[model samples]
Target: MMRSPANKIPADGEPELPGVPHVHVASVVSALATLDAEKAGLDALAQAMAGPLGAAFDVAVATIHNSHGRVIVTGMGKSGHVARKIAATLASTGTPAHYVHPAEASHGDLGMITSDDVIVALSWSGETVELRDIVEYSRRFDVPLIAFTSNPESALASSASVVLNLPVAQEACPLGLAPTTSTVMQLALGDALAVALLQSRGFTALDFRQLHPGGKLGASLKFVRDVMRKGDAVPVVASGTNMGGALVEMSAKGLGCVGVVDGAGALVGIVTDGDLRRHMAHDLTTRTVDDIMTPAPRTVRPDQLASEALNILNSRKITALLVVDGTVPVGALHIHDLLLTGLA
Candidate 1:
């Protein structure tokens, strides 16, 4: 028995047999072909969205947006997996949505959907046997039914109130049996619906933060006031204070900088390590803080997002930002603070 190239592992620096592709090379080719096929499918989807699908998509978005209840997303098999992700995206983006497996819908999950709720079903063929119960339930209750399918003539599409007819395209799978390009199209369409609804509702970043309060995204959306060190934690010196006193305040506060406040308690300048280095001289300690400070140093408003403050810190190449109310220094934020908050 002769070992084929696939069964025979090539040793280091050994050439592959003539007219035979290495396993890795064949895999790369397959991967590239899959990508190309998916890309083609996406192109077709984009074209459909611009053409016949536009009116139906708008109607679907409006139907979901105007609904007083949550969106019930349902599908079978690979489409079920995509439906779950779509539901999550919709929920996170301010639209109430949840997935119900078609198989489970027949087994008593049908009660999970209400008459007020809208049903968004995903089925490439639109004839999934498991989806029949959901379709019937939607029809019986007069619940709004939105269908995603390539076959507009299929049972699901014929019964749906809004049929988003997907463009039939070649599958990424070489055998053309697996749900590859079709699932991608469904997922992309689901995202489009979610985003359209989200925009229609005027959902803000603060709203998003409220929904996602425990992650890095939450930290990034936090207000500067929420992260800044307030009150006595901020290092400060009187406008006319000498560099020696300013240095003491900076060292005591450990923020590497001291804010110089005028008589009215408004921030006028900042004395940083860089300023001290630039003003280095025999009389440096005796110099007035004004002489060693940088006037109108970059500052962030307390109401600004921490992510914006991070941007300023990175662009200015500085480690600290003074949080201000008008010209009054109320707080200080260090790069370390942002890092601790997981914003960096």
Candidate 2:
């Protein structure tokens, strides 16, 4: 064992300083056991879905699709938290959705719901009192109701057009009163619904980018064309151009590299600073660009995501890449460009 030089225990208990207590191995084991139990509960929920519940999921997806308005997600207590997250997930994934608190719905927030919209009500016990008003309103207005709960016979489930009754499982909480395991089931089921709807609607990343355009995620989704230097800014020289001219172009473009193109205007090779360094002994003024260029250099497409370009640059250990459409060089991207845009 390596001890720090600062360590100096008091000799013969002259004074034992107060210190952080060591964690008990038994407590660690118990915590791990709890996780295992929760995972098993989730697993049971998955298994239960293989039967009639699977059909109910399909029906729910179809109901949401056929609706002309947004999905109004309603719930109470911890279930309300899960409902809000589910609503956000659905909205971001192309299915328009919003959370409406059941208690608030009774106090005129119910007006936010329309007959054209579908209601997704969540209640672990399926008999939450706050949900009664909205459930009754949904029934009265002929609004489709889909329920996610643990009790099929409860009011919420009985009133729903589609009831997804989750399998009962023990809570990870020792007191068996906290919402732990039940909330996990609700969240997982909600995620499944969102993904199913996303796939059904053919939701693409581009559609997602439209909804989320203010973070690293949005930056990662930006296309190469959005950041690449195009036209006269791209450092290019004819294939037979002299290395001195190529170096001049590389410097002028300030990307530390120049692209070599053939007579047909097709990119044939690239000349980087490293290429110049390796050919330093040669007469660069007389050597043709092709004589010292790296042929078939790694290239990115104009439509590729910036993150994809970053991956190419990082994996190749290079600073710049030529953006091409097939064999023709259209643009160039330097690592600094990505850094400037917060995409790196």
Tens digit of per-residue lDDT, candidate 1, span 1-344 = 99986677655764444555665655666787899999999999999999999999999999999999999999999999999999999999999999999998899999999999999999999899999999999999999999999999999999999999999999999899999999999999999999999999999998999999877999999999999999899998999998888888999999999999999999999998898888899999898999888999899999999999999999989999888899999999999999999999
Clashing pairs in 1: none
Over the stretch 273-338, how does candidate 2's per-residue lDDT look in tens digits?
899888887577789998999998889999999999999999989999999998899999999999
Per-candidate TM-score against the hidden true structure: 0.93, 0.90
Which run of 10 residues does model 2 get worst, by summed lDDT?
A: 15-24
Off by over 4 Å in 1: 1-23
lDDT of 2: 0.90
Model 1's alpha-carbon lDDT is 0.93
Clashing pairs in 2: none
